[model samples]
Every structure is written in C-alpha cells, then in structure tokens.
Target: MAAPAPTAIRLHRQRRVLELTWADGRRHEFSCEYLRVFSPSAELRGHGLPEPMLVGGKRDVGIARIEPVGRYAVRLVFDDGHDSGLYSWDVFDELARDEARNWTRYLERLAEVDMSRDRDVVKLAALVGQYKPPQKPGG
Candidate 1:
C-alpha cells in the first residue's frame, strides 16, 4: 500500500515541534531534538553503519527551515548548520509511528556511552586531555 501523503506540515518554533497532518487523517508531532538526532544524513547514519555515530548536544537545536524535496521529502535546515538529511514521507511516518520506541533506544544508547544531550558535556569530554583545573588562589 502507498504511504499517505502529507496534507499539511507546520513547524511551531515556540514549541519546537514539527506538526504533520497526513491524507489518512493522522497527525504526528516531532520534536526538533528528535529529528536532529535521527537525521538520515550520512553524517549521522554513516555510510554503512558500524553503528551510526551517537549525536549529542542538540538539546536546543531548532529547524531553521524545511524545504521540499521533489514532492517526496523535506530537507530540514537546522540552526546548527546541518542540512543534509532528506526526510521522505515514508520515513517521516515511520518516525512518528515509532517515536516512543526509537526515543527509548536513543536514550539507552546514550547511557551506554555516558553521553548526554547537553553540549557542555560533550565539550568537557573532548577537553579531557587538554583542560587543566584552575588552581586555588592561595594554593
């Protein structure tokens, strides 16, 4: 069966959610963070997945724009300058349908590696080898 086409798509900036209404009378709301972490771009999914890269520090990322892709998908431009993922209708539907499960898995993966959605945490981890703790004034 053919996938239902999107009848309407709206990005609510204040709420940071992508609201999609389909021809089949289904509506799905996707958070910007969710979309960013699950982007279909090669950078995120990797060329062949030896386990795609774990993305962190996207807690406040926002969709800068959503451009149509040949009536089949959308290219979401993120505020952080990522714009490679092409979210097709089918993929969008799958994301909406499997949101709960997928999000749980993502959290689990993050936990497994001690990573977080906080950018500061990622930066601190990257500086582990170079950062020096500040000395006390009288030490």
Candidate 2:
C-alpha cells in the first residue's frame, strides 16, 4: 500500500482535539491530554529505554499552539509550557492508529504498579524539580 498524504489538519483549542485527514479520506482524532502524556521526550521517556514514565492528572490538558517544523514534523507548544518534542508525520499517524490500544495498556500498567498518574505541578515539583532542557543540536 502507498503512504497516506495529509489532506487536512485541524486543531480545536477549546476541545483539545487534533484531527488529521489523509488523502484516502481517513480521519483521526487525538486528545491533547494523551499527546501531552505520551510525548516523545527524554523528560517523559528516558533515553535508551522503552519504559515510559506514566503521566496522570492531565484530565484537562489544553493545546497551546502548533508550529510546523518542516514538511514532516511539527512542534507542539503545550499550554503547560512544554514545547519540546518534535512529532513527525509517521509518528503522529501511528499514535492516531493505535491510540486506544496504547492508552488501555498504559492504564493497565499503571494499575499493575499500583501507581496513579493523577498529578499536579505542586506534587510533581516535590518529586523532581527545576529541570530545564538543554538546547537541541542545530536548532
């Protein structure tokens, strides 16, 4: 099968939904909360590890802004001042396709570890604090 070309992209700031339509007429919707938690960043996921840090208490995350990087990737500036990870088209497509399954697995893992993702800034700072990301190379 050929790769799908993006036909349209929409972001609903109020609803916190990012929608994408492909050339083949397939559409997908992803929530800002999910994107924030599952961000592909070292802060969220450590380097050289597939194990991810569970994120919770993001029942109300909002989309701040979406900036196009190039033809393939986009920089998502979240409302919570997280504007790091660069999401490419393929990565986004995978997230859209397997969102439900991945979320289910994440929840299950959290439950198995007897952990709660529900967290506020006050609570998180107590755990790990004042981390400013170093500049990305060639940026």
Candidate 3:
C-alpha cells in the first residue's frame, strides 16, 4: 500500500509543534525537538549503524522553516542550524505511529548517558558570550 500523503501541514512556532493531517484523515502533532533528534540525516543516523548519534541540548529548538523537496518530502530547517534531514511522507507516517515508543527509547538512552534534554550549560554560556568563574572567597 502506498503511503498516505499529507493533506495539511502546519508549523506552530509558539507551541513548537508540527501538525500534520494525512489523506486518510489521521492527524499527528510532533514536537520540534522530537523531530530534530530523530532527524533522518546521516549525521544523526550514521550510515545505518546499530547505534545512532545522541543529540542533546535541543530542548528549546524550533523549526525555522520547512521547504518542499520534490513532491514527497520536506527539508526542515531548525533554529540550531540543522537542515539536512529530509522528512518524507513514509517517514512522517512512521514517526507519528511510533512516537510513543521512540520517545521512551530516546529518554532511556539519555539517562544511560547522563544527559538531559535541557540545553547544555557550557553551550548556553558560550552563546551568552561570557563565562564567569566561580568566586573563591577568603583570600
């Protein structure tokens, strides 16, 4: 059976959600962070390896834009400068269908690596252009 085409696609930046409606009347809402971490790009998926790269510090990432790729996929440009993933119709369907399980697995992997979905503190400091060392008292 052919994959159902998206009848509508909406990116809600305020809510950081991608809303998609399929030709078969199914609707799915995907978080921007979820889509970023699960990007189909080789940078994340790594040549069909058993273990894909773990992406972190994207808790507040948003979709900057979505550009059509041919007639079957979209190139999602993220706020963090990731623009390589091509989200195809079949890929979107699969993501929507497996969101729950995939999310759980992702969270588990994060825990195993002592990582959090929150932005990395070091990166945040760099972005802010300052790193103040902790003060030492009683010199």
- Top lDDT model: 3
Would you list the clashing residue pairs of candidate 2?
A: 56-117, 57-118
lDDT of 3: 0.87
Q: Which runs of model 1 end up more than 4 angstroms from their true locations?
A: 120-139
- In candidate 3 the C-alpha lDDT for residue 51 amounts to 54
Total backbone clashes of candidate 2, pairs 3 or more residues apart or in separate chains: 2
TM-score between model 3 and native: 0.83
Would you list the C-alpha lDDT of every candidate in the order shown?
0.86, 0.77, 0.87
lDDT string, candidate 1, 6-96, tens digits = 9999999988899999777888899999999999889989888965578877889899999999878999999999999999988897788
What's model 1's overall lDDT?
0.86
For residues 1-139, could you state the per-residue lDDT of candidate 3 as single tens digits?
6476798999999999999997777889999999999998999998867755888778899999999998889999999999999999988988888999988998898766567799433345344666567788975
**CA RMSD of all predictions:** 6.9, 9.5, 7.8
Using Cα atoms with residue i matched to residue i, what is each candidate's TM-score against the true structure?
0.82, 0.75, 0.83
Tell me which residue pairs clash in candidate 3: none
Overall local distance difference test of candidate 2: 0.77
